[model samples]
Target chain A: MTDPSRLALVPFVSVADMMRLVHHIGLETVLTELAAEIEADFRRWESFDKTPRVASHSDVGVIELMPTSDGSFYGFKYVNGHPKNMKEGLQTVTAFGLLADVSTGYPVLLSEMTILTALRTAATSAMAAKHLAPKNATTLAIIGNGAQSEFQALAFKAVNGITEVRLYDIDRSATEKCARNLAGKGLTVVPCRSAEEAIEGAQIITTCTADKQYATILSDNMVGRGVHINAIGGDCPGKTELARAILDRSDIFVEYPPQTRVEGEIQQLDADHPVKELWQVITGAVPGRADADAITLFDGVGFAIEDFSALRYVHGRLRDSGHFLELDMIADPDEPRDLFGMLMRAG
Target chain B: MTDPSRLALVPFVSVADMMRLVHHIGLETVLTELAAEIEADFRRWESFDKTPRVASHSDVGVIELMPTSDGSFYGFKYVNGHPKNMKEGLQTVTAFGLLADVSTGYPVLLSEMTILTALRTAATSAMAAKHLAPKNATTLAIIGNGAQSEFQALAFKAVNGITEVRLYDIDRSATEKCARNLAGKGLTVVPCRSAEEAIEGAQIITTCTADKQYATILSDNMVGRGVHINAIGGDCPGKTELARAILDRSDIFVEYPPQTRVEGEIQQLDADHPVKELWQVITGAVPGRADADAITLFDGVGFAIEDFSALRYVHGRLRDSGHFLELDMIADPDEPRDLFGMLMRAG
Candidate 1:
């Protein structure tokens, strides 16, 4: 069999490679850079070909393909969400993504997106908080300290200048795990016993529970007037973290309304309820935090553009990090019309 | 860093591995088995989740994601079609696919689909012909002999008992390449100067061209009684191979009506144009090939179910074949909620 040409090879970053890349660039820097990339993409969001994620739902879970293109490049992520996976000692969400040149439709980069998704999700939240959170917000209350909690805490610390994180989860061990993971990470990690206790003196409250139903992680009265709410867990149709009353009290901002209305916490409200697009806020076309006394909500459902940004960012880092393997993924026969001949030669 | 667990590793079949596996299984046997698998899936078609491919179109080409699931397993293929790429010495289409567990929402296999797509497409065309073609059919005339022509010829020989293939292409060199590839493949290869001469004594006419715009490769007068038409190239909007008059004269069958109406040769007809689903015919709900003299047309805009069948078949052959690489594409921590801890330990 003949060796594949260079054009047929696609750079692939496995989980270990992604971890190495993250460490090589430093987590804080990665988070901050990812935030910057995402923000930059959001600034010119109209140039993108955006669509609501295409999701296939089964009885147990859902698998989705999130695809978006920005004229020059195309990107998509294959992600599955199964909340019951936790009990099976598996991640509730696992993903992989690809970036390709739009002109030729050839994949240039393929990366394990489980770690990248977590990073991008946190980075997006922190980026939004930078625009919506009250000034000098130093403390963050993270409700549901699970797999995503520490990343959220660290991202907020890096991007939004949060110096302390108060963690709480229904499962006590999860809180302890998050706290332990965040130890000596340049932030004060406080393990709180109750949801109210976690939000005691924090200006930003992040709800990231892993329930698959409409369970209210936070209620109307529990939320104060001057706090920024980062709702991340309420990502699918029947799953939401905040109560409808809490949504009514906050000025909600979302990634993409067509998608958020179907999958985010905004699903709890009326279909026509007014909400701001986060990109508009970033581009200075829409106001973020209206007043110091107003409640601000960033309902992030994790859009395709953020994943696109993350993959593009990783593709750029491949040159310096050298933490990728090239897989002979595309079949580039010497003669474009002789694919069968190529196979015959291999035989 | 600790080695990734078994759950994190996904088996990836590169183009070389796929080629070797195909040669190991024998190309003819692979085509026959793939046809049988696709036919079996077609028989139980209603049990699967079906959606038209999600396409992202650019000025030069298009990238598409085709996804489907059958309760137990979910599969998706990422493919691109760029007719202009041929001018730059690139294949018109390249693809990769993934199969995942529906229950856990985790990828089980990742295989290079560029070659597999060519194989599956040919297998599907031949499988459809097996049902719709006249009994004792022996000759296939393939128009626009490009990368797909040789595979079509071989698949017909393996699955439908075709003994001769007449090939024609606007570019005579493409026809020469195809004729050379199909040499000694247990079939008579005839290279023709015109589409008319190619179908002279052939029982089946396979139109597989690469032009992106609407251009009639076969007209009403070129088609005759009792011949089955396997329309393969008019797969996108504004790109068709057969004349509308020919479609009106034949008994048209389609894989998925909602999709074929928008992307097949039948797109030239009315929205309410009557067409039979190939699965219905395979399951015996609808009859195929009404009479010996009646022309039967299979307007196949390749569907997701066929790719699912192909991926499922490849996945089943992995155990003994062992023609795959284990990729650490999933982040499987010992504790499901300790992903951050896993990354920190990697550091």
Candidate 2:
């Protein structure tokens, strides 16, 4: 191999570049491509390295770093969740990620995942719903109507042919905001007064409430048979929304079994509760939705592979469109051994 | 908090910006400011959130993520050590780091620390040496003089006022490289045949060999009274240089006791072997060196806080010079509630 130091530094995709990519490719296309990449990566699940995230919890919130590498590529996401942030006029969850070459440990791209995260989360929901939800599903009831509600609504529209969305939030303004964001998206938006009203007769019930407690947004009787439940918000030890009765009645699916056991809707379920990993469903190694009457629950807690796929998707789009700036994040010493030369030259 | 959505997007500084900061401030000034920041951060040690680094080890190398936060700001370093990398014409160690806001979870700066790590490691050594070494120290012995030797020499110059450096390495070319790198720095660089020849009468001794196994570089008799030892290279399990007799005879100081007990030169010694944390010395809670006859050993296994301080210093310097590029690493929704709009509109 040629000297690694002699290789030209890789181009970095900054947040601005990522936004430009969205503008150039169109947001719908970005989500479409990102979803496709995630699906492809998930299908070849055995080809990557996986690990449970390392989390540091504080009284106000939790900070986590999710890392995974596919032997050749390494990706990690740094995210924070502070329920009180919204009260202080901050978003409840915020994140960013990095993509690097495993061989050299040099970052190849850094993209803004805050918006991308919403896109991916929604895409992931839609992706799971594709396999788990009944075909020809039309309406999605998004109970939370917060930052993630819009993405969830549109992703279902693009993937599952959903033409209608029922939005409900404790704060009416949040529900109004969701409707307004989805106004021109060619989907019918319904404003609901209560979570029950939103979930009533909906084919796909997405529970994304922000409460960091075990509050049942969907009870056992309210969730009917053949309805797909995309549980998005409850993702911590003390935080979960689905009642145990609801979980026991549904055929559950999870992103990673080890992680989902702790952070997904299954947190309320017993350890012995049989669940299928999403990858297994995608790979056809396990069955998804044994019968139409069997209610399917996609216990989505997000995963590192999704971020890796999102990063890879964004990197390709950003690089092709010339939307990024070159970050001198790596020191290019003429002689890698003479790192002191950089200092001497600086002096 | 103007609409919270408008402020959600965070700014990112790239590596190019960090190099500009170095160009604008000069390396010595940067190192001095960095050392001062490290000292300040150490003084307030209890206010920060600390965690032991997470490392992924491979047969030929090890990659680690060291993360920490001070309630408000978060930092993490991605570093790798492959002693064989140099032979493949790559630096034995390469690193990059990030600094972010804890409130918004936005990355503010990304910097190349492969070179800066050497500087910070040297700065950390000098800081410990200042507190532990005998007063008015001059001659210094640097065993295993490789890529890190020049920085060690200069940092000692900046902090300990050492005028002469004795260099010895198993690879003759590495010692020659060290000598070449320090030729005109005004310090007398003497190339020696062995560790014994290098430390015959030195007041300060620094060992930084790169072997992965336990190799005794220094025994009891070779180390004399009042000689402060900066043990830098033996930083992982199954990797240590100093014999047990040397540790038994010395007054050892460490960065963090829990971490040092696992990864430091003291790994060869008993678990309950008494040691002093560097922060305690900085806070004046613990004594450094009692007298001229006392032998003080700084088992430097590299700490997360030093990386935190270094990243903070780099962020401040780069921000001041306007060299940092704004990476749209943070997602900014015009209306925080309209995150879906940002993505949908892009599509």
Top candidate by lDDT: 1
- Candidate 2, B91-159: lDDT as tens digits: 678788888777656567767787778878988888889888999999999998877888899888877
TM-score of each: 0.99, 0.90
lDDT of each: 0.95, 0.81
Q: After the best TM-score superposition of candidate 2, give how far the Cα of residue A222 lies from its true spot, in angstroms.
A: 1.9
Measured with C-alpha atoms, the lDDT of residue B93 in candidate 2 is 82
Clashing pairs in 2: A15-B328, A26-B346, A26-B347, A27-B346, A27-B347, A28-B347, A328-B15, A328-B16, A329-B15
Off by over 4 Å in 1: none
The TM-score of the first chain in every model comes to 0.99, 0.96
Error of 1 at B153 (Å): 0.6
lDDT of 1 by residue, B220-312 (tens): 899999999999999999999998899999999999999999999989999998999999999889999999999999998899999999999
**A31 in model 2: Cα distance from truth in Å?**
3.4
Task: Rate residue B337 of model 2 by lDDT.
Answer: 64
Lowest lDDT 10-residue stretch of candidate 1 chain B:
B177-186
lDDT of 2 by residue, A1-347 (tens): 12224232556654455566777887666667777889999998998888888786777788788888887778888788878777765667878777876665656876667777888898899989999998788889998989998778878888788999999999999999898888878999999999889987799999898877888888777888889999988888889988889888889899998998998888887888899999999999999988889899998999989999988887776646987765555666666667776555644
